[model samples]
Target: EEDKIIEAEAQKLKEKFKEKSLTDKMKDLLIRSIYVEMLGHDGGFAHIHAINMTQKKNILSKRIGYLASTLFLDKDNELLILLVATLQRDLESESYLEVLSSLQAISRLANSQIMTATYDQVHKLLSHSSDFVRKKAVTVIHRFWQINPNGVVDIDRIMKTALCDKVPSVMAASLNYFIEVCRQKPETYKDLTSSFVVILKQIIEHKLPREYDYHRMPAPWIQMKLMEILALLGEEDEETSNQIYEVIQMTLKRAEDLAINIGHALVYQCIKTILAIYPNEALLENISKSIKAFFSSESNNLKYIGVTALNAMLKIDLKYAEDHQENVVECLECSDDTLKLKTLDLLY
Candidate 1:
């Protein structure tokens, strides 16, 4: 049956083209490989590219894309492919995107499966021109960091390179992705928060207002990402919460990090993030009296943030329940569902 099929294809090719140049031969090879891939033999794609009939048509890496995506569905296969792809120093930019996409798919694979990340390749792709391509690299790298729960991306090196990104989209993508992975594995990223720290520190040194020019905002993808990681970090660590508090303090006092409108919105969002992830006792014990110390003296923004965080504190065990009753009453009066349920249960 195989012999008959080959014969049939030979007959079709011969009759389809009696005269062909080198260019035609190359096109034929590409078309045949595409056909072969469609028939399920993806492993042969590289060799297929190597045998191109045209001298001018460089199809080697481009043809291999079809093969790499299949590796995305399986971890063992992915790691083997990653090793091979990473070893090839001349890989075109397209191959990097293929690799990044494959790794992105890995997040859906079995959680217990362990695989190696091509941190070198990921670092390279972060500099590419395409936003989508660069963004995929960010997601894959950040996810890997989450799995390792350690700062393997070389925080210092990343900080040095991050500011070099020609495009804010790329810079934001890299920083925000790092933050997300840290959020996922907070216990591992304490020192790795340098990017955010650096940005905040810069804001303080220049005495810049939180209000920056609205014309130069982080890309939408980056903004959402920072928000996500912020919420996650707040949910995971006391130190992170405190650090955010410090950044907030810096933002309030320095007022140099943002412009008036953007600063107002971002400050609210930042403190909200801090409250959401602050955990129940993360603040009340050491900072409890200190928290109440300035409760009534600040901006309405401060009051809102304090009350929200205060309500989170109100959910303690029965022994500590009575201490935050007024804050709980304040929380219950608001019309948010989650806030209402949390405070009403205590009141009843």
Candidate 2:
């Protein structure tokens, strides 16, 4: 039944393309609808139409074309090679939106072939005038790194520059990239620890632009990513651990004061970081208080996070779990079975 519907839709799309009178707006609409229908199935018939759309001067048509191509073609698809020139042209286009759309398409459809063909063009966009372009470029580089690690030369140089990018969105994207890289080789990125610490300090002080604020929290996503990266780098390294201790303490204190859900999330990330670094007794007690507070929350999500954090803390020092026994027991009565199961794991 589904395949028959897709065939009908494909045939209608083909007929629409045959009509030279069809407006770009109408073409875009038809392409979008057919794209949705073609999502999971083999959409070989619409491939040529999608390719034709990429050749159109209309920006909307180009976007739909790139999107459709992403859906129809995988990394290994032979047709992907044909997109290399078009993608490269858009990557070098004077328009930032065009460059952004091309980067996005490459990021999603990236394979060894695409990465090999567009490596330099994508790399050059890292310094594009638009922060939006720069941000997307960073993610494309990250994808390229994943596709072919050896292809991305001078990674340390690339990351150092990206981490210091003035824009919050770019910085956040770079941090995500760094998190992936550092997870595999923490020692290589330990030198960049001070840089991350400085960025976190700036964020904590509300130095980022007002636009980046989420519910009055200054770039909460960036803060969370920083904490995660710090955890990875600080693990079993005393000097790296000591350098971030003060900032981590400040983060915990700040996170504790906010009443919003983002605040709770920051607090949870701080707890995980505290565990990774050998935190002092005072910090441990403070985190314990935060975990206990979660148990009192009406939100099951908060309760679940609290239970999970407590379980992790116990592994470091079973004594911490002793204080949460009552809270853990209270969780057993919650209606969420997943939360109850986590509580059971803590009990065991």
287-326: candidate 2 lDDT, tens digit per residue: 9999999988999999999999998888888888778777
Which portions of model 1 miss their true places by more than 4 Å? Answer: 1-124, 127-132, 145-160, 163-166, 175-268, 272-308, 313-340, 346-348
Top candidate (lDDT): 2
Q: After TM-score superposition, what is the CA distance of residue 63 in candidate 2 from its true location, in Å?
A: 1.6
TM-score of each: 0.40, 0.92
**lDDT of all the models against the reference?**
0.47, 0.84
State, as a TM-score between 0 and 1, how close model 2 is to the true structure: 0.92
In candidate 1, how many Å is residue 36 off? 27
Could you tell me which residue pairs clash in candidate 2? Answer: none
Which regions of candidate 2 fall more than 4 Å away from where they truly are?
1-11, 14-20, 23-26, 29-35, 38-42
